[model samples]
Target: MSRDIHKKPFDEGTKAKLAIFRDYLREWLPVFIAKREIYWNTINIYDFFSGPGSDGFGNKGTPLIILEELNPHFDNIISKKLNVNLYLNEYDQSKYEALKKNVSPEKGDVRPYSIQIENLDFKISFKSKFPEMGNKGNANLLFLDQTGVKHINEEIFSKIINLKQTDFLFFISSSTIKRFAEHPSISRYIKLNSEDIEKTPYHKIHRLVLEYYKSLIPQNKEYYLASFSLKKNAGLYGLIFGSGHVLGIEKFLTTCWGIDKERGEANFDIDEDKIQKGQFDLFTNEVPKPKKVDLFEKELKEGILNKSLPSDKAIYLFTITNGFLPSHARKIIAQLIKENKIQKSSFNLSTKVCKSGALVTQVKPL
Candidate 1:
């Protein structure tokens, strides 16, 4: 976890991505800070694995970005009997000290700051900070940005989901995982931890990682909870944003995705208004009805071995879901067919939340 040779100047790709993340946060925090009738006074942001702020080439970290935008809102914050708590955690003392100095005591009418620097691993630090969180009912939104998923697994994720009123936006940095996903040792780690998941196929592993967390949500009778996830890109990098509130999930996606350019690598098509307004809407669910899953099931049923030639229907659905979409019911059916592990007649819905986020309804096979 120490510094390495690759730590030269900040990676341009990562820096640009962070800029987009910060911009979205500024516009959206104001809305959340004052949106509800509920007296929203204290704002708590925990940045675990917080690296040295203002890294090489002056790439402002998330902590600084949050403070710059939020400090001004404190005018409205304390006026309404509110406080802002920024819990910045970095095991590296040098970096932590730098951050502490960066956002020190404020001037008159300035937002008051209470900062706690924990020189410990993320799990220990978070557990100490929010002991009640691992149980349930303590409202917290965690930002888990790690260099790798080596230490992050389902068990840790399970403990996090147990917290009531908690939402998580985790950066499952893929470059690290992709390197080890196919390794036998890594596969052993996953299989030993997740007994039901037999395949380590990238997307399936992605699904397993998310579903494992979802399973941790206490099956409470009074609360209607549907925990969900978001994967940024296959394994190179993905964010698993979990929320009990559906709207919060929607808002999270609306804010973060707005900043994403629809195209990749050599191509880019960022909506000017979205960019100017500092919003990320790349994955907004504008379509009224979730696209049908029949197409996905059939395509895979026929054959989806070739990645380059996605079936026409698959292409259309990909366009509909903005590349991240997948019809679980359809995929399950097709996968079962391909492997002879499941039957088509069993496709009749027995009450399951559909991927398009539609209500649990009886669905006949496509």
Candidate 2:
């Protein structure tokens, strides 16, 4: 049996992971709430592995954090008469009872939104709730905080890929996959090469797992996936966020970059960038730079000069897809303009700009 995490006070790593979930929800709720009449009229949120509402020290878990975030939106939800549903499920019987007691409408004051607390296994819960998620008028957010990496197999992920207006956040014990790469049970779920898993650095096992999932995306599809690695003690766990729309990716990336400005991918310095020495340019002195940002900037500059990124819209997509914010891409564009490599153009890289048909000028090379 898997160990229970809520028996103890939530650790820093778990807190960090929950923080991302909370922050993303803060950004996520308003979009659908504001658009209740205009776009999606209903919002569905699922926490598949919700624990008892809090840890031993009473630090709020995902269920409580979610309610706290949604509390502020109750007025808007009430005014618009929007249909918002929250599904919180815990597989463990003990945890489920605790979840019910803690998350009861009377206790949490979550009466404004329709909420359901279940004690089903993830697979069963997902199967039952999936059809509701497929509704065209509903916006869905699914959080799978599984104890291990087995629940989100290819079969499950394939179904998620086909859903229209859904975004998902998945947690996995990536280090477990590395440690048990060759195990028969593990291989059955994720078909990664044992040799390759062994060769990957310990800290990057989570990223490797994410890459495996990325490979599962269909070539013709335009899905976006990003990862945030959490280092807990000696093990590495991570969260993978997925969405079909650029706006969803934009929100997630914003939350991630806010947490880890250096890499926008982890709680710690995953790249050991802080210790690395900056190469001195004989002509000009420069401060040490972050490795990931430097690499992304170099690629962004090359893509523009090569015409691979030919317009603001294309650059905007490139920026988010490469796990960056528009501001980062704009910084590169600013330098390019100063160097006379590209002609001046409207640097408005917002999705609204794309929809408004304003980003028409092709990036002219000088």
Candidate 3:
């Protein structure tokens, strides 16, 4: 039930990740909250691994970060008289108390948020209460920012993924999984039999685990996955985002590329193009070089050759297949039209244009 019992300072990589997650929520919350106008009446945000409000070294954990990000949105929602719910769950006693204290409004502080702070185990809390949350017609964003993968087993993930319009940001230490890929306690969750674990290359274990878990998700659901890795020396841990909607995936990748300047896309494998020895660039955003741009353009052309894909579906296929952002795909699709390699049957070639039911066809060679 407990993670590494000893406490340590929150590393810089973790802090950068927290900032990226916060920025993503800052952009996504308004759009998500406005869903009340079209689809849902309420938005529920669940921070399942609500850590001790801070690392005790001045660095705030996910719970405090999420609360701060949501405060302004909460006020806006209240002004509009719409409902938004915050569910914060922490199992550890001291951390739970800290989470509750941190989220509680001080004297005369009127923050219009319906906050439910809990001290129960996340699995039990999620399983018992998720039915109500799922049935409420709320767009739920569950943050499973755990210390490890213990609480995010197959059963829990399946339950959450089955809920309607729900998205999750799950944190895991790939180093831990690589070390324990053959361990009986964890092997079953990743669907790795003892034999497969023994035979699989260590470098490939993370992909195997990710793909296995992804396969468990419902096939009929249009799910998109993107992972952002936080590197500490040779070790890497990161957040895996699962969303049933394309917009969710878009925002997640946008955050990933924004935070990690050394890497353009969300690739799980460590890249040879390492960042400066001791530097982390949280501010600089280097545009993809011409080489990478051409690679993506080539993939986009291959995506629709001889196939008449709806503009929206083509973007989805191109993005998923190439690991480029949706915007990247749109840019390449536009370039293709200009070069006479692709034709758009309807609207002008643009990011939002694709989703307008326009038909896109690859201009086959004569």
For each candidate in turn, give its C-alpha RMSD to the true structure in angstroms: 11.6, 2.3, 5.0
Candidate 1 lDDT, 76-177, residue by residue in tens: 665555555667788777777776776666566345546666668876887787763443322355677676565456576666655565666675543334
- Best model number under lDDT: 2
lDDT of 3 by residue, 91-174 (tens): 889878877787788899876668888888876888777887677657888888777667778788778777887888887766
Give the Cα-based TM-score of candidate 2 against the true structure. Answer: 0.94
Please give, for residues 184-263, the per-residue lDDT of candidate 2 as tens digits: 78899999988889899889888899889999999999899999999876779999999988899899999999999777
Q: How does candidate 2 score on lDDT?
A: 0.88
lDDT of model 3, residue 348: 32
List the candidate 2 regions with Cα displacement exceeding 4 Å. 107-110, 275-284, 353-358
Best-to-worst ranking by lDDT: 2, 3, 1
Q: Clash pairs of candidate 3?
A: none
lDDT of each: 0.50, 0.88, 0.67
TM-score order of candidates, top first: 2, 3, 1
lDDT of 2 at 42: 84
Please give each candidate's TM-score. 0.60, 0.94, 0.82
Superposed model 3: Cα runs more than 4 Å off:
1-6, 34-38, 193-205, 262-269, 274-295, 305-312, 343-366
TM-score of 3: 0.82
